[model samples]
Target: MEEIRPDENTKPLTWKQYLVIASLLFGLFFGAGNLIFPVHLGQLAGAKWLAATAGFLVTAVLLPLLAVLAISVSHAKGIYDIGRPLGRKFALAFMVLIHLTLGPLFATPRTASISFSVGLQPVLPAKLAQPCLLVFSAIFFILAFIISYQETTILDSVGRVLNPIFLLLLFVVFLLAAAKPMGAAHQQTVTAAYHNMAFFNGFLQGYNTMDALAGLAFGYTIVSAVKQLGKTSAKSNAKVTASAGVIATGAIGLIYIALIWLGATTLKHFKPSAEGGTAFNQIVTYYLGDFGHALLATLVTLTCLTTAVGLLAAFAQDFHRSFSKISYHTWLAIMTFASFVTANFGLDTIIAWSTPMLMFLYPIAIVLIVLSIAKTAFAGDPVVYFWAIGLTMIPALLDMLASFPPVISQSPWAHFIKELQVRLLPLAAIGLDWVIPAAVGIAAGLLVHFYRKRPKQ
Candidate 1:
């Protein structure tokens, strides 16, 4: 095999090439957790599934596309570049946090846990769930590690083979759900949390799919994939990046709607379950029975494995490049092990803990993306980034603190912050308290930047 070199090719990509990249992005986004989130949201939102899905699409699909475009347009090779204007220390810290959240700490492990929990564990004995989880996760991560061990092969594995099979199986589920309806979605009872605030709750629900975080983390993977096709010039790469992102997110958006409808209608035969895995399992069994179990096992494994490998490959590549002394394989091993350990904590537990972190990181990630895309307007000014990020962090941190489990969040300091947030934050009622502060920071930064640059008479 010969080495592949990227050229300064600025021409438009053929439709075939465009489809391939779109498929790759779609595979990366529509993974294990992705399957469950919107379905689960449907169960929660019930009658308001459409409104809820709209909010989910904003973060789950739209924000992620923006994140990829941010990388391409800003010419950022990775998260480090995206945050470089914030200063080296902040940039490094931000990169590590982003990687950890999107890697072993949450998203990567969720791939394994959700796959096992959904596909197989329900049939096993209660006592067996823990032991089986251990066995399953070990095998899952090992397979993921082996696949991701060779980075170049990830595109082929995900885009060509695994993603297509999972989609086929998913199509069967969707078709059956539509062909024979469980019940009218509009007649289902909306849960209390989503009764009045379905959209906002659904917006926050999108946080669970973790696509937005994965978007920032997958920056190098998408850019590298595009370059492999010889589109290396900034303008060309940005165009392709934005286009592929749209194609991919468009597919994901449709899937989310179908799944949400599935969830809402299932309420006829089933009460809203604690998680999407349960709703999905009930629907599959109703439609396909024991055969569905085998099918789901394969479907879950394929979807989760592809995503796991992609995350591991991206994680190892970025970490190895950043910390050269620690070999790529070593970093891969470290994350793989950590993720396996975390997976055994169970799917619900992982999600419960994940929310707080997602709450904190989502705001920061959004702000960073916005700054990167609008960098030229402010001339790539660090002051703008610093103010925007710093102010965003205060509210983001409060949200994180309040989102934690009652044992922690109910404490004096945490409660104080949450109370203060409710009292003072403009959008606090809707769980978007970060918006006002972030905008104010941007306005403040631009004002200071121009003031400092004005004639010093």
Candidate 2:
């Protein structure tokens, strides 16, 4: 065993240590949403699965890997530090919004909903469905709260226990899927929405995993776990963190491909489902029958439990730091309660409502992570941060409105705003209208940076 001293610079973590952190990272990010969304994308993309899968990997896997690197390379302890160049008030607000989205409001609650909808809903009678969901979510959040009450156990709980079981269960499905595919995906008909722009829409679809946001939030947990392993220096931590992230996201990427492929193949047997949960259920039930449902229920519940713990811990840690008036346990309880309430809204409603929020937040998050990773090249200029983020916000908001369901989006005022967004912004139809504005802001900010630093000649 290697001695790991704290406070001094240390060597890179050994392979064993690296695997531990990777396991923890994979488990933290690989909950129910990860399973549901990719499977759903496969159904939608159909014959277009390959291209859509490629784009899904970019956002779901690559961006998340970059998000963790952004935290490590910048020496940011949390999301707030990543956005600190923009000033205190701005950074604080950014942190709050992220915590809320990834916390009680959306992602945390989603853990329970995904578990319920996919694992259990298919087996219950329709009349009992709604009430069963309420009971399930309550049990789910209570377990998460108990597990999260002891943050010190996260590494052991997730990495050693939960993750291995998840991998084992998932491998069974993958093995069966690969050994006997239902039908040729390429032969399947591509859905209308995917006929033209499957790749880009798939890119957007990855937003539901929320792993990019999770990456940023989970930095503290990842770093803390590494420190517990004795890689103490900032540089050492950064290198180890990046290394573990690669290993973890690599595993996730492989699973995502398999899941999407599974969904694509299932089109031969099952019709399309509204939320991915239905598709996931169909695929699993086809392979394992009633026994598969039980297995899936166990799998998702454990996966979601670990994810809930991670989110609750991160939320409590960040909130406690910002608002010291409340203690960590208190914050944990508050978030757990809130997530329980939201989870009862049911999976479909949660997915529907979360679309616009994800669209709003993802663009800015992508820009922030990119800029933070490149902070050294630009001298960590505040002007660059302000310009890039400020300009991106407007289009991101428009992206949100544009993603709303027709009921809201078709209204006169909403229609007019969307039209302006489409007319004024490039890639508006693709939900990437923020890209050009973000680029322009980056350029404008760089001009200011160069002007200020030009050697007083």
Candidate 3:
């Protein structure tokens, strides 16, 4: 809890301090999902890696950067602030949903499950995998619980030691893969989804990373860390927060590119597999032999652990702050239990079930972030926020329906609704049915705002 302050005559923080904060932010954002998705995309995209990655960067990198900047510049206390312009009830509801999605409901459990499946499962005997997962998850959440228990030092703990190790291990993997090509980057046939619109497919695929949502979740934490570093003024905090975001962005972007290339090169030697974890495991094992497996396991565990700790701490802190009757330690304990149980469901099931929920939530989060950042352009009107998000829900709902299990999506009623959505809503096929509606809502809201403020005729 010690706030590091510089002498009045000195700069706010040295370059070293900024690097540490950036490293912490990187650690907070880069999780197991980050590892799996891009590699999968690379395997799928084959020759279209550049176009696909460009689109992936928009949502995966740009949106996250913007979310951090939006939170800082808005001077919001937390994710709730971004939604406040919509309405208090809406703010609370949205924040709770976002937190749960990013917490026990999906992302947090996923970190443990993915690390287990990708890192640990590959090395374990077939029969031992399930039991090992249970054991690993228990230990994983316990570690997260202990780290997050002392929330004050979360930034320093992750930034100083954990992140550097994760980055160094990852860099070694990337460098080895780059220096020695696995195989020629042959042009394989593009998958059905990416056949023509690879970029947009990549755009939608980026959603799987869930980093943008994390951006909103972690924004307050980043801001608080900047303040802890003695950048207390609103403007100063925003500046440092943005700087830290840029540093994290650069680091994440480079790693993503490297991973994508690594995945692509594997296609020449191995066919695209259904599970990214499998493909990733093969690549590591091929390049570094058994040694690479241990290194990857270590890398995945540390990366996922850092992310889980940040999320558990963030969620516990927010809920405890909101409901003071329940202590932060109690909430952390509750979350740890919930996440441990959820992680036992296994990574694939968690991902399969969570996709529909993410489809529903991500658009709303994106619209909120965009409007929050552009509040000045709309004169900070709450009406704009309300209308835009309200209108967006229509297509977002359709998107959720589209991603539902076949039992639901293939039902007669569901088919009729989806058919109607595809016919009426632009970009429905691409899973972006919300865009046009949101645009119209923004226009309508702006007109209403101007009309309401117009002088008497």
Candidate 4:
């Protein structure tokens, strides 16, 4: 290990040590949502599985990798520090946005719903399913609250327990899927555009996982693990971050590939459906019969339960740290109650409602990831950060308004947006209302840079 800064806060670990940390982080990020979504995408993608996988990997895997890199490079203590270039207000707002996205508003509750559907529903009677869900969520969240109350060694212990369990369970399922193929995949009927478009949809869907944000938040924990093992220099930290990212991505990527392939094979036997989770369950039942259901139930419950506990703990700790008046216990109680309410909305409803939010948040996150990785060019240019962030916010805001089609159709502002859509080339190209604005901001920042640098004489 390299001799680095000796700050009490910085601990040292080796490259191998870092890889273990990264794998643990990866397990934390890979939950029931990760398992379910790709299967759904593959089923709909049909012959376009390759395209969909490529798309899914972008947001699902790559952007998250970039986020990890961003934290590694910036040495940010939190998301707010990374966004500090834009100013304190912006950084705070950005942090709040990320926490809310990953916290009770969406991801936390999702952990419960997916866990229930995959784990408990198999044994519950059809008539009793709704009531079962209600009871299960209550019990699940209570356990989640207890686990999340503090930072401890339990996280590592749980990682060791569940990580292999998830891998082995999925490996068995995938092996069986391959041994007895789900009949045959449908003929590739999707047009090239649909293939191309699936990538973007997958990219967008990736936002729902919020791993990109989690990457930013979780990077430091990995860093600390490395430091404890006696490797704390910037270079070693980078190596650790990269290695961990590769291991984590490789592990989850394999899982994702297998699930998506299974779903693709399922297309031959199952019809298209809106709810990916339900569709996934149906396929599991078909192939493995009753045993399959039991296995899937246990797998998802463990995945979802662990994730819920991790998230709730993260949110409560961070929120209490950020604002001190509220007691940690109180915050946990409030967060648990809120997440319980949201969980009732169910998986399909959660997915439906989150699209607009994802659409809005994705671009800004991408730009930040890009900027973070390509920091040299924009070095010391606060103006660039401010301008780019401001530009990205416009589309994000509009996306929220236009997220639901029916809502957009009935809104009085629909005609105005329609008119703007026709005039905006970038929006037309990718439904990105902010492309033109981002370009303009980049140009403006460069102009400002040159203007200030131009021979101050």
lDDT of each: 0.85, 0.85, 0.82, 0.73
lDDT of 3 at 94: 84
Q: Summarize candidate 2's per-residue lDDT along 278-364 as a digit string, tens digits.
A: 888787787888888788888777777777787898789889989999999999999999999999988788888889999998998
Report lDDT (Cα) of residue 418, candidate 4: 51
Per-prediction TM-score to the true structure, in the order listed: 0.94, 0.93, 0.91, 0.90
* Ten-residue region with minimum lDDT total, candidate 1: 1-10
- Against the true structure, candidate 1 has what lDDT? 0.85
Clashing pairs in 2: none
List, residue by residue over 175-242, the lDDT tens digit for candidate 3: 88878887655566567787788898888888888888888877777877877777766567767877
Candidate 3 lDDT for residue 326: 99
Arrange candidates, best TM-score first: 1, 2, 3, 4
How many clashing residue pairs appear in each of the predictions shown?
A: 0, 0, 0, 14
Write one digit per residue (lDDT tens) for candidate 4, span 1-457. 1234644435554466656777666765687788778887777677777767777887788778778777666666778777877888878877887788787788888888888777676567888877877888899887777776654557567667876876776777777888898755556345345566876665555666777778877666766665666655566666666777788887777777777777777766777667567777887788778888887787778777777777777777788888889977788888899999888877777777767667777778777766666666757478877777788778766666666556663577865775575565465435566767777776787678768878856
Stretches off by above 4 angstroms in model 3 are 1-14, 125-127, 146-159, 228-236
- Per-residue lDDT over 148-208 for candidate 1, one digit per residue giving the tens place of the 0 to 100 score: 7766575464556666667887899889878899999999989888888888898999888
RMSD for each model, in Å, please?
A: 3.1, 3.2, 3.5, 3.4
Better of 2 and 3 by TM-score: 2
